[model samples]
Target: MVRNEQRKLTATYLNGVGMAVLGVGGFAPVVSMTLSGPTSSIVPVLVFGCILASSGLHLLARQTLGGLEE
Candidate 1:
């Protein structure tokens, strides 16, 4: 049980790092494109990035909370 707990903690931390990278790395290109492209084209890219980041965070939170509960 303790080993499992440790594993879960590690997974949660990794998930957080992945989410951070996804947010920054994923949005970097969108930010660049928005600056160079038309407003209409950039809007969708920004919205999609926002959605992706939020969902990743939600999943990360769920994983962390589940580990805590266990």
Candidate 2:
């Protein structure tokens, strides 16, 4: 139905966003810091990235599982 299609589309978007954030916000900073020497605390960046990635994944999972009330 249209609802299911919408869910799939939303899930796809969420997945893409999660992957992008994981790469740019999470791993990219860690890699950059390791290669160039950290001038600031990497913990905050890692934590922030992880939170964002996990949130995105969580939303994607919910949509993929098909939940209109969730």
Candidate 3:
């Protein structure tokens, strides 16, 4: 069905974006920590990374959940 194909397409794009952001977010905290050292200031960077990664995860979850959400 077209709807099913659309879902697959959407899911594929979502997964690509999700994984991309997740990879970037996963490295951000480490890069920040390595460059800046462990400090309260790093908390913001870590939080930013966490937020990005969480958003990516949400997208991935949506991709996995598929039509259940629609």
Clashes of 2: 0
The C-alpha stretches of model 2 lying farther than 4 A from their native spots are 46-53, 68-70
lDDT of 2 at 6: 76
Give the clashing pairs for model 3. none
Better of 1 and 2 by lDDT: 2
lDDT of 1 at 47: 58
Cα distance off (Å), candidate 3, residue 47: 5.7
Candidate 3: tens digits of C-alpha lDDT, residues 1-70? 7777777777777776766665566666667778978766666676577667768666775865467433
- Model 1, span 1-70: residue lDDT tens: 8766776777677677666656665666568667887546566666576667667765765676565543
Clashing pairs for predicted structure model 2, backbone only: none
Name the lDDT value of residue 17 in candidate 2.
Answer: 76
Off by over 4 Å in 3: 28-32, 35-40, 43-65, 68-70
TM-score of 2: 0.66
| Models sorted by lDDT, best on top | 2, 3, 1
TM per candidate: 0.45, 0.66, 0.53
For all predictions, the C-alpha RMSD in Å is 4.2, 3.7, 4.3
Q: How much lDDT does candidate 2 score?
A: 0.73
Error of 2 at 68 (Å): 7.6
Worst 10 residues of 2 by lDDT: 61-70
